[model samples]
Every structure is written in structure tokens, then in C-alpha cells.
Target chain A: MNKYILSKKLYRNELATFYSFLIGFLIALAVGSLILFIQEKNPFDVFSLMLKLSIGSVNSLSNSLNKAIPLILAGLGISIINSVKLWNIGAEGQIFMGAIALNFVYINTSINNSQIYILLLLVSGFLGGAFCIFFPAITKVLFGVNEIITTLLTNYIVFGLTIYLINGAWKDPASLNFPAAAYVSESVYLPTVLGKLSSGFLICILFTLIAYYIKDKSVFGYEMRIAGGSELTAIYAGISAKQKAFFAMLIGGGFAGLAGAIELLSQTHRVSTGISQGFGYTAIIVAAITGMRPIGIFLVGCLFGALTIGGSVIQTIGVSSYIAEIIQATTLFGALVAQFFFSYEILKKDEND
Target chain B: MIDVQLMGLLNATLQAATLLFIAALGELITEKSGILNLGVEGMISVGAVSGFITAINTESLFLAVIVGVLSASAFSSIHAFVTVVLKQDQTVSGLILTILGLSLSSLIGKPYVGKKLEVKLESLIDIAEPSNIFQVLLSQNLIFYIAILLMIFTAYILKKTMFGRRIEAIGEDLKSADSMGLKIAKTQFIATCVGGAFAGLSGVYLTLSYVPYWTDGMTSGRGWIALALVIFGGWKPYRTAFGALLFGFLEALGPRLQTYGFEMSPYIVKITPYIITILVLVFLTIIKNGNTGAPKNIGIPFFRENR
Candidate 1:
């Protein structure tokens, strides 16, 4: 009889981690297939159809790329703070705050030029998102409040505030009670790369490079890593962990805010409660899957972008669109589970330690 | 001058608080066992959808509640495996469970949208007779009474029972408890399952007794609110119940204030409860240390030295 034992790996293996990620995604797809089968549709055809809709054609690919822009930016934002051991769950609220800022400028100003107006709106968005997390970061450092709960609570507040503005104060008289702010002027719209793709996609790539440089090469990143790795060590070395936390969170919030601004200026053309489309929450999963690496965030962000577009595609094929969410969530869960295998091994009985 | 209408509002507050208290009390126990399960919202969504689907088919509330508890517990067992057995990070694992729970619930609940259950449990109050303050207080559904009993029972067990002491010991110092020969993993796993069950019950109550229909994302942020209440209560079961009631009164206050003909946006009114929760948390943090009333080893996964 053959015997097998599971034991801990002596060292971390990158190859194992990579394989586990693929296997995790495969498992998630299998689960998703079961959901499709339950709905009496062919899972293979649906998957292929999803692929076609998201990346198989120029038009659909452009739409998917547009969606990936915000996700990539938001994922990058989450990655920054996550590296610092601070979970900034307020990205959703920050995105909304950014939209609010963008709309404030759009409504209150007549900067109808393409070049200057877009730049101002983008800056305001960054500032708006940064302001949202400023209080939580300061409170976390000063009062020792858990940023998790505070950030989450802030999301609900922003959700309610957004709804209020859309339904009341910011409701465009031209929208005719549709509960949406007025669309931005045509010149304010983001320029297209191709026919339908927005310039926001290029900005996403640029931000990814910038985030990579900040995370890997910069002094602030070095200090953040040391502080996140060990507060005691950081304190002993005279690093102000509090300051790093504050700045890291601010940058994180700013990236997500930028996503919100791009979403408004490029795709939606107006502010609404659904501008985020839960990207803030989904970005967490993307950041985690990528191990908080900037480039990994971009690729995974696009995958999720495809998943979401596929979800809407499934809706037209008689399967519930939420199947996309199931797959997205399951993939993350499976990845976490697969991580266990990379770190440890299963052993048969009577195997010597 | 408080009128009968105001008494009715307070009465509604009690009912709302009952659901929060039930979930918070269960979470209090889980935290006492040193596991922080942030997937309370996800568990409730699954429980609510499963319970409503079962009730619609069986026309039996008891069976539906059982199904709710079982499915939610079953779902949380995945969390138990990840956090307890694998010794993974609790926050990430809990968040994953929440995403899965919400997605799965929405997918399954897609069919049941806009469909009403046949056996909805209305208020326990009989409307045939004239109402008074006492009647208004007692008019809540069966779950309200059960929540009160559960609170007292949980408080007693945690304070007096040997099992509770062992779990509390585990929460405070897992290494010491393990050295003392206590089964840390088993106790924490059971506590998590029980917590998941209670969250499920809260969902069933919401669907069966309160809303009487399944709605996607209907649990909303209530599970998160329950998590906040557990902390606001300082980890004491009875105190947590009080916190839940206070939160409920604050939530109930929003709609009541609108009745006075104020020009406030209803959406702004909806945000008051969340804002108040934040204020209370900030106040508590200022008055006491972050670790005050919290288990020392909460959120850390425990690993045994050897098999």
C-alpha cells in the first residue's frame, strides 16, 4: 500500500502559488458551470458567449476595457493601503465623494474646454477621495479606532448622501425626474483611444506604472513596508508609522477617487448612485488575488472587468446575471483556499514528522 | 406631549431591536471564543433567502427556520474550515464568505423576487381590543420574546457555566488555555456555528415576521450594524442588547421625525443611524482604550504546536 503525508514547505514557492491561482479559478468556473446548468442552459456556450462579449470583438472589447479602467485604478488604490497593513474599506465612499466633487465642478463652472476642465475634474476627484479617508486615518492613528468599521460605516453615509443628492439637491431639471444629475458637456467627455475606448484606459496604465514605482522603488514605500511588517521594528528605527499610515491611506483613497472621476467623465457622463457599481468592493478581491502587486492588479482587474461584462451578457441568455458575482466571489475564495496548499501539505497517517 | 402614536413608534423600535440583538448576541459569543466573523451580513442573506424559499414551499414557519439555521450554519462551516482549521487571516476569510454569501443568495433568490409567502407572521398584538402602552410593548411577534430569553440564557451561560469560562479563557489567551488542556479549536468552531445559526434566525425573522418576502440585498447593512452593536455593548450580552435597542430607537427616530413636516430629505434621514453609530464608536474609543472590553486574542488564528 502506498502512503502519502502532508507537510509544511521549507520555503515559499512562487510556482506553487501561481499554479494554485489557476486551479482556484478553474474550480470557480466549475461551480459557475453548475449554476448555469441549474438554469437549464449550456454552460460552455454561455462561457464562450461571455468571452465573445467581453474580449472577442472590437466593440465589446472596448466596453470591457472601459469597465476595466475604474477597476484597475480602484484595485491599485486598495493595493497601496493593504501593503501598509491598513484596510481602507472606505474606497466606495471615496469614489462617491470623488463623483460628488467632479459634479460640483461640472455644475458650478463653465469650463467647457476638453483639456483644462478634464484636468480640474480629475484633481478635484483625487482631493475629494483623499478628504474622505483623512478623518479615518487620523482617528486610527490618534484614537486607536478600528479603520475597518469606521470605513465601512462611512460607505453607508456616502451611499445615503449620494442618493439624497441624486433624488433632491443635484437632480437635473433636464433629467425630468429620472433621479440623475445633468450630463457633462460633450467637450468635457474623455477622448477615445479608438472608436469607443476612452483615454481613461491610458491613464489607468500610467497610474499602474506610477503605483509600481512608488511601491517598489520609493523611500515612502520602504518605510511603509517596514512599518506594516512590524510596528515595533519601525518604531525602534525612528520611523513614524502613524505618518506613513496617513499618507498611504490618502494615496489609496486618491486612486479610487480618480476611478470615480474617470467613470463619470468617460462612461456615465453624469453622477448617480450606481457610478461605483460595487467596484470598490470587488477591487479588494482583485488586490488580494494579485498579492497586492501593481501589475498583477491591472491584469486581475481586467479579468474581473470581463467577469462583470459577462454577467450582463448572461442576463440576455436566460441565466441570472448574478452568476457572474458567484464566479467572481468563488474564484477569490478558491484562491484563498488554494493558498493553504502552497504553505502546507496533507499527510497520510503514520507518516513521520 | 407623548401620544399613543409615539408609544406605537417605541413599540416598533422594540421589534426592530429584537433582530439586531439576536444577531449581536450571537456575534458576542463568537468574539468571546476569539473568532471575528465579519460575514454576518452574508450569512443573513443566505438564511433569509433560504428561509423564505422554504416557507413558500412548505407553508411551515418552523421548518423554514430550521432550514435557515441549517443552511447558514452549513455555509459558515466553510468559514470555520478556513479560519479555524487552516488558520488563515480572519478578516479576509470573513470577507470572502460575505461575497460568496451575497452572490449565492442573490442568484438563488432571483426566482423569488416579488413573490410573497403565504404564512407571514404579523404582530402578536390583537387588534380587536383597544390598545394601551403595555399592550403596545407586548404586541411584538414571537421572535421578540425569544430574543429576550436568548439574551438572558446567553448571559447566564457566559457568566456562570464552565463551558463559557473555557471559551472566554480561549479568547483572552489561547496558549494558556491550550496549556491548561482546553480544546480551543472545537470550542471556537462551535461558537462560530452557533453565531452563524443566530444570524440565520435574525434573517428568518426579518423575512417571515417583518418583510414577509425575499428581496435581493434586503439584509442591507443590518448585519454590519449588528457587528457595531456587539462592540458598543462592550462584549457583554445584556449590554449589547441595550445597545441594539438604543440603535433601534435611533433608527426608528428618523421616520418619526419626518412625520413632523420637516423638509429634510428622506435619504438624509436614513443616514442618521449610521452616523450615530460612528459617533458612539468614536466616543467609546476616546473614553476607553481600543482593547477595553474586547477579547485580547480576538481575530488571531490559533495553531497547535503538534498533532
Candidate 2:
């Protein structure tokens, strides 16, 4: 057998990503099977059960679709910043702030018009997420601070704020010592399109389409690509790297916030500590596995949503729901490894010689 | 009464600081070698659960710590291989590692939750009567002393040793380091493992000595805090230790103040560390004119063929 060497590819190969994801996804399933085997369960049985529960029925599919809404929005948000090579790990916190901001508007407003109130809530949610990321963005642009740590740190701060509000100012009088905000007024609740599926699905799809257009076909996206590629290159090309980074990060934050808002208005209907369920962090995986493409994010988001639903379904059979998270993370790792092959091709010893 | 309370406060501060310092020092080492491992949180969780389970079964703190450190080190190799060999994005890989670690821990540790461990690492210098503040400070577990020693050792290695120089050179400029015949991938992989080992040790300290029990999300956000402390300390060993202690004091102050009948909200106290971290980042940037002592090639993947 001849030795093989990794040779760098001169041109981008789109099919590489597709193959990588496919192989990565299979690897993830293998790993998940191994975990199930270790737990004394039939991997085949569990896998089939998960598949059936996630998309086996129309109702289950709708539930999975509903779950995908937040993931898609947050994934899109994270993807925008990823384009600029910026990490927005604080989407978790941005979601909290968005929920809080939407609740704040609901608690104070007396608006009875459904359309106007829903619009107001959605905008507030977007603004809330942008506001959450404002400090990290400014510091990164102005002071050269690491956005990753700053953004992650901000999540904890926002969690604290959420707890403070839930326990003090926004605490529902009827909650009776349990810490949570009052239910959002029905006037602003997102209309349900099907069983458990809300109109937020359309909003998320619309947002993804818009994001795709801007990121792929617009000058701003072109400039962001340049800015993210290299600061020197961006400067040479007359693009303000700092400004682009700041705006991209803000937009990312807004998307995360909007995710939180939609989840609140459509699903939970009240601000609680468990509103996010780590959706923000999971979105990072969704965004990564999809190669930060808007359309791919939507598809991957639904896949993960199915996995999440499958996680809960498996809980009925003595399996922990954390299986979903484990599988998701493993998939991302597998994809990262697979992506390496995309950038470099394997050459035989004779070929190299 | 005040004197006793003050001593207790100092003790709690030191305990908290030890946990943060160990993990932050680990991160500092990894970052020093030009690899940013955001998976510190995940590593700590894996270590904590594995160590806790081992302590419960084996009833030996030594074995527990070794198991914790080894497992975490092994887990970190995935990161090393992906980032160093495969040349993937360190940030995304590290984040995924965190997710994987945490979920893996929770999945495996599900059986061991709330089970108490009989073996505990007790204070080495158990003074029956501590006469002064120094004695009070000295009355900490062997791991606490080990943390201090590790800090000193880290400082020495970074500032004085050839290996340290290699790491610094690779982190600062990989191309030049490669020209000088340094082993970039090997040094980085080892450094990342060492970092993982330190994080594991931190987790063992938490389960065996500090809280001495297993709980879901027990490490909470301490891993993230330790990451911030690395930056807040400006990536220097001693300064990082100092920053850890300062944050530790804030952490300890919350419960102590409640006991003292202070009405400050716990939420406010909890957020203080994060807010202060951001402020410190801003302050450090302003004072140093944006030249924070981060490793220049900190998160950039190295691909020799491309270069």
C-alpha cells in the first residue's frame, strides 16, 4: 500500500461540503448507536423509534417544525456573524433579553389590536437581541476585545437579569412563589397555522430568504465576505472591517433575540427560566453543520428539531433526552473533521512523486 | 464576631479562587500554544462527573483525580487533532467539544447524580487552633496548595524554560517558528492536553473537595468565568491568579453577605463578576492601547502546506 499525503485544493469544491455532511451525519448515527448499545438498549429499535417520533406523523412533524423556527432564526443570526469570522455565542442570552423585552412591552402596553401588538412585540424582540450584543460589538470594534469571551460572559449577565426580573418586577402575582412572568396577552400571541405550528414558521422562512438574498446576492454581503476574509484586504478594498463586523454581530444578535420572542409568543406564552432550552448554543451546531448557508440552515434546523423531538420521545423508553445534544455535538465534530478533507485532497505517493 | 466572619470569608474566597485559577491556568497554557479551546466548560464537566463517580466507587481521591485528568486529557485530544492536524476552526470545534462534553457527562453521569462520595480531600494543615490570618489561609486542602504551586510552576515555565519559549514562539508567529525547526503540531497538541489536564484537576477539586457531590450543571458557569479570568488577568499566571481570587471574593461575598443580613439581591451579586470582566477588558484595552497580551495566533489554525 502506498502512503497518501494531503494536498491543498486550489479551488473551492461545493460537493465537498455535501459529502462531508453526509459522512459526518452517518458517523454521528454510529456514535449514537454505540451509546445506545452501551446502555443495554437496541440501537436499531431506538433509532427507528426516534425516527418515527420525530417525523413519523403529521402532528409530530409539525411539532418538529415548530421547534425548528427558533433554530433557523438563531442559526441564520449566527451564520451572518460567522461570515465575518465573528463568534456570537451569546445568542442564549440574547434570546433571554428578547423574551424579557417582549414581556416588558406586554406588561406595560394596553394595545388591543392583534396585528399591531404582534408587530410591536416582534420588533422589540429584535431590538432586544441587538441591544444585548451592543456592548460586545462595540468593545470588539473599538477596544479589540475578544468577542467570543465577551459574548459568552454576557449570557451569564443576561441570565442574572432575567432571574432578577422574574423574581422581582415581572413576577406574576398568580404564579404563587414559582418564578416566572405573567402570560402574554392573547392579542399579541402568534396565530397558529396548524397543530402546534405557529405563524412564526412563515416569519422564520421569510427571514431566511431575506438573509439568503442579502448574504449571497448583495454588495453588503460581498463587503462582509471581504472584511471577514482579511482586515488588510478589506481596507485595501475600501470596506470598513470594523463597521461591517459591528453590524453583522448586531444583526446576529437581533436574529437570536427574535428567536426568543417568537418562542415566547408562539409556544410558551410566558417568560420562564427554561424558555431557551439551550436553543442558542444548539444553533451554533446547526449553523456550523450547514456551512453557514441560509437555505442549508433551514434544512439542518429542521433535522435538529426532529432530533430534539426524538430526544423527548425516547425519554419514554428510559433514555435521557441529552442523547439529542450528544448526537448533535458529535455530528458537528464529525463534520469539522470531514470539512478538512474538503480543503485538502488525498494524493498517493506515486502521484506526489 | 467580625474577625471570625472575615476569616471565613477569606477561606471561602481562596476555595473559589483555587477552582478558577486551575482552569484559567490550563486555558492560558493552551492559548499560549496558539490554540483556543472554548471546550474548557465541557472538559470540566466530564472531569467532574467522571471524578465524582470514581470517588464514589473506588473511594480513593488520588485515583479519582487521575481518572478525571486522564479522561479530560483524552477528550481534549479530539480538539487537538481537529484543530492542529485537520486545520479546522478552533472556535467552532471547541464550542462543539463543549456541547459534546457536557452532554456526554450528563448522559453517563445520569446514574451517579445525587450519590455521595465517602472519600474527600481534607485540609493538609488542619490546625486545631489558628492564631493568625496566615494560619487561616494555610488551613486549606492539599489541592489548594497544589494550585498555588501550579501557578508558580506555570509562571516559571512560561518565563524561563525553553519549552515555554517554543510555545510562545509558535503562538506569536508559527511561520517563523516553523522556519526555526520547532515542532508546532506536537507542541500545540501537548499544550492542549496539559490544558485539559488542568481543567480536569479543577473539576476533581470541585467534586472531591469543594462541594463533594455530583449535580447536573454543578460547574454552572465557572468554566466560562475561568475563561474570562484568563483575559481579565491579561494572560499572565500571577495576574490571572490574582484576578481569580478577586472574582472568587465576589463569589464568596454573596452568601456571606446574606448571612450578615445584607439585603443585596443574589442576582445582582451573581452578575457582578461578568460585568466586571467586561469592564476589565475595556480598561485593559484602553490602558494598553488595545495591545492586550493575547497570543497573536491564538485561534488561527496552522496549515503548513498552505503557508
Candidate 3:
């Protein structure tokens, strides 16, 4: 006859999050190494090669940064919604919708000034993502529907829609049978600031600063925090919990959309089926591992960006690029475990003695 | 000719429904026990690849099914340990499990891409030439019959058994269930594992009977649809089965409609399941006023001391 009690610690150990992330990251590396070993590859050589190719030189680093741009934006988007305790797991679809919208503008408009063209495309892109989530957000607010399923379902719908567009209306004639839209005008390409580093990197950092200000310092964020913590408390404090949630979802969608537009302008130069490459989904991991901190998302985004680039680079060596995804997922699991220990502890107790 | 075409459509519908029903039923059990494992997609992928690999290696459909189910169960245990043992956020943990499952399967299944399974599950009814609709329906693989039996068994268990009551009790109110000498963590963990097993079984069906081959990302988003079916069915076994059949009908309608001279695009047909899920969710929410038969304690990690 015995009883054990699980108790929450009175004071939060802030350091635990950092330590858990470190340990979790290391665990993911170990798992990745084991997988490589199982495939008869030298784990040490593979690891070192990945590191060298991803971050060894300026050009390689710039490539990683280019890859990180969309992740940073999408991660920031997910982080914003996560702060309000909402799951916007449809970021992948949102990214697609954003690209679709940007392409729509490109096809319809005949503007000569690239700056105005880019600005308009960005707006359309943001609107597209927002439009995709609008139904789910509204339904959640009005009918109390679970946004997670609704949002996730929308991803499939958008995916189908994207395929439809690329295969039909947007299919480029000069593409020689490829199912993709025509490239934007040459002037519309985003200017590179460094060795192949698009200005999108600076844009993402700017977004990070703004998101940090809004999430941590603004009155709106404080109210959102209150709403997320307890609706009743928010109501007592005269905050409209529904409004906070609705707007937060829209902003999250907008961020994802902006990411898609930036990717199109700065990198892809055209809307294709392969535009996103799971950036939105990976961004969720980035957001979680960073504890939804904007700056942390930026840093982790770069790391993942490098991992993704390195993953492709190692394909020449006969390794599966999915190793990056596996490591990322394992790291998230580690963080989850770390989060558990950070807040609670188990104690043994004697009963009826 | 019309009769044959109708029967063909019916057969396809049944096959697709079988896939969704098994997975959704597993999810229903897990949700009923207060765990929402969103990693069903990953589990299905793992199951399909693992089962395909096993079948290719051992050339035994039975052993492939067992390995598939066992591997998925073991894969899902990671979610159980994190959410049940460590008390982490179920949604986040489940999502992570999904990411892990998907990538791990793709990585492991890399070399096996384009490989075909020589072993096949034969139809239970050995009518060399079927003369009637009933005979045609009866000529499905053994797994099809097993799925029907499972549906009935699940309905009965949830309606009439104490074990089912324990699951519902834990889901509805974990604190009360815990206080009443119920084994909270054990029930949830087992339910989640059982759910994973069902997903694995579904995967086995895909590789062994449905397609008879392995491909990367083959499961696609069927796992997500299964999750939606659980909601659309309002957490009841029979209703969930009905929802699965409805989805199956949509999936079957696509290729059939094209054959029947309908001018619908395949992409439009592909999206019907997802679109219907959202509409049904909305419709259910409106009618039920957001009180759909979801477990009250679902997705919330339970800790006795928190009370």
C-alpha cells in the first residue's frame, strides 16, 4: 500500500529549458549518428562533412541564411500564435497560399517599377495566407470549433488548389512541360546583400525585432498572454478573449504568407509545387525549441537552415537528406521531456503505516 | 454493365472505408482514454514501410502485419512515455511523434522504394467466378472481414464493457477517475498503443492488399483524415465507421466518376475528403453548440497533485 505524488515546483527553473534543449539537441545528434552508422557510413566523417558544408565558408553560410529566411518568418508566425496557446499547424498550407497569391499578382499586374511590384506582391501574399486561415479562425470563434483540425484540413485544400493552379491556369507555356508559373520579371528579383545572401535575411531579422516587441513588450501581447492563460481572467480584465485569438491567428497566417512571398522573390523566382519544402512544418519545431522567443527563433532558424542545406549536400555521399528531419523531430521530443522536468517532480510517499 | 460498375464502386468504397475505419477506431480508443496522439500519419507511414520491408524480406503477410503493428506500437510508446509519464503537452508531444515517425520511416524506407511485395492476402471467399453482388462483396481479403468484426467488437466494448467505461471515465474526468482507484496512466498508455496498432494494421492492409508495393510518402494524408473522422463521428464507434464509409465513398467516386464520363478534375476529387471534414466539423459544432462528444479531459496532461 503506497502512494506517490507528482508536484509542480514553486519556482520555475529558467535554466532548465536551455539545458534541456542542449541535451535534446545532443540526443538528436546521437540518434542521427546511430542511423548513419547503421547505413554503414562513417558517422564522424558524415557529421564533420555536414558541419563543414553548412557553415564552413561565407558562400555556404549565405546559402544557409537564404534557406533560413522563410523558416525564421514562419517560425515567428508560429511563435506568435503559440504564445496565445493556439495550434496553427497549417503553416505549410499558408505558405502555399501566400505563394499562390503572389503569383496571382504577378500574372495580373503589368507594373514596371519592381519595388512597387514587390510591395504589392508581399501584401497579396499576406492577404492570401490570412484568407486561408480566416475560415478556421472565424469558425473557432463563432462555433467553438477546434482550430487545430480546421486549420490542418485547410492545408490539404490549399495543397489541392495549388496543384490545380500550377497544372492549369498558371502553367507556363515556355516552361517546356513543367508544372509551374512563369518567372517574375528580372527586376523583381530581390537584390543580394552579400555572397548570394538575399536581402531577405535582413528582412527576417527586422521581422524578429518587431515580433519580439509585439510579443514581449506590447500591451496587446500582455492581454493576449492573459487570454491564453485564462479566459475568465482576461474577461475580468476587460479583454476580449475571442478577439485576441482571432487577430492572433490572422497575424500568424500573415507571417507565414510573408515568408512565402519573400521566398518567391528572393530565391525561387517562380511559384512551383516545391516552393515550400516543409518550411512551415519545420518552423513549428524551430518555434517550440526556441520557447517562442523571437530572437531564439532567428538563431535556431539559422541552425536548422544550415542542417537542411547540409542535408542536401550530403546526398552526393549517398545519404538520405531526411536525416535532418529526423534530428529535428528528435530534438523536439527532447525539448518536450525537458519541459516536463522543468515544471514538475515526482516524490515517493508511504501510506497507511 | 451498370450493375458491374456499381459493384465495382461499392467494392472500392468498402476498401477505402476499411482503411479509415481501422485507424479512426484506434484513435477513438486513444481519445476515449484521454490521449490525443496526432502522430497517426507518422505511425501509418512507419507501419506501411516497416510492413512492406518485412513482407519483402520474410515473404509472409502474417508476419508482416505483426511486425507492422508491433513497430507502430513501439513507436507510439514514445508518445505515451512523454505525455503520460512526463506530463508534457499532448498536442505538442503528439506532433513531435508524428515528425519523428514520418522522417524515420522515410529514412528507413529509402532503400525499399519501388519494391513490391510478392506475398498477398487472398480473398476469404474462393469464388473463382462470382455470379452475384453478395458473392463479390464476400470475396474481400481476410482483413476486410476482420475490420467489420472489429467495428462490431469496438461498438460492443464501448457500450457494454467495464474496460470501455474505464477509458471513458479517464477521458471525461481524469482527476475523479484517479481518485476513484482507476489506473489513469496505464489506461491512457494502453489506449494510445492500441491506437498505434490499428494504424499499423491499416498500413499493413495498404502494403499487403491495397497496393502491394512500397513508396515514399505513400500514406499521404490519410492519417489526418482518420483524425477528422474521429471528430466528425462525435467519438462514437458506429458513427465513426459511418463517417469513414462516407469518406471512402468520396475517394472511390473520384476515379469512377472519371470513367463514367464526368469532367471533374482529379485534384478536385482529391480534396473532397478534406473539404467535407471541415464542413462536417462546422456543421457538428453548430448543431451541438460546440458540445461534440469529445472527452472533457482529452489533451490535458493529468497530475493528481495539481488538483
Best by TM-score: 3
Clashes of 1: 6
Q: What is the TM-score of chain A in candidate 1?
A: 0.95
Error of 1 at A271 (Å): 0.5
Candidate 2 segments whose C-alpha is farther than 4 A from its true place: A1-5, A348-353, B127-131, B258-262
lDDT, candidate 3, A1-353, per-residue tens: 54667789888887776788888899899999999998999989998999999999999999999999888998998888877799888899999899999998888887888888878888898888888899999998889988888888888899899888878888888876578888888888889999989998888998999899889999989988998999889989999988998998999998999888888898888988777998988988898888888998998899999999999999999999999999988998988887877898776764542
User: In order, what is each prediction's RMSD in angstroms?
Assistant: 2.3, 2.1, 1.7
**DockQ of every candidate structure:** 0.69, 0.77, 0.77
Per-residue lDDT of model 2, residues B170-240, tens digit only: 99999999899999999999999999999999999999988998888788878888888888788899999
Candidate 3 Cα outliers beyond 4 Å, as residue runs = A2-4, A348-353, B126-132
Question: What's the TM for model 2?
Answer: 0.96
Error of 1 at B222 (Å): 0.8
Query: Tens-digit lDDT track for model 1 on A1-353?
Result: 42754466678787665666687799899999988887888999999999988888888888888888878898898889987898877788888889888999778887646699899999899888888888788888888887888888888998888888887888888877467887888888889998689999999999999999889899999999998899899999899998898899999999999999999989888998768888888887788777888998898888889889988986886878888878877887788788887887766767454
The 10-residue segment with the lowest total lDDT in model 3 chain A: A344-353
Q: Candidate 2: which pairs clash?
A: none
Q: Model 2 misses residue B112 by how many Å? A: 1.8
Weakest 10 consecutive residues, lDDT, candidate 1 chain B? Answer: B122-131
- Location of the lowest summed lDDT over 10 successive residues in candidate 2 chain B: B298-307
Task: Give model 3's DockQ, 2 decimals.
Answer: 0.77
Q: What's the CA error at residue A64 for candidate 3, in Å? A: 0.9
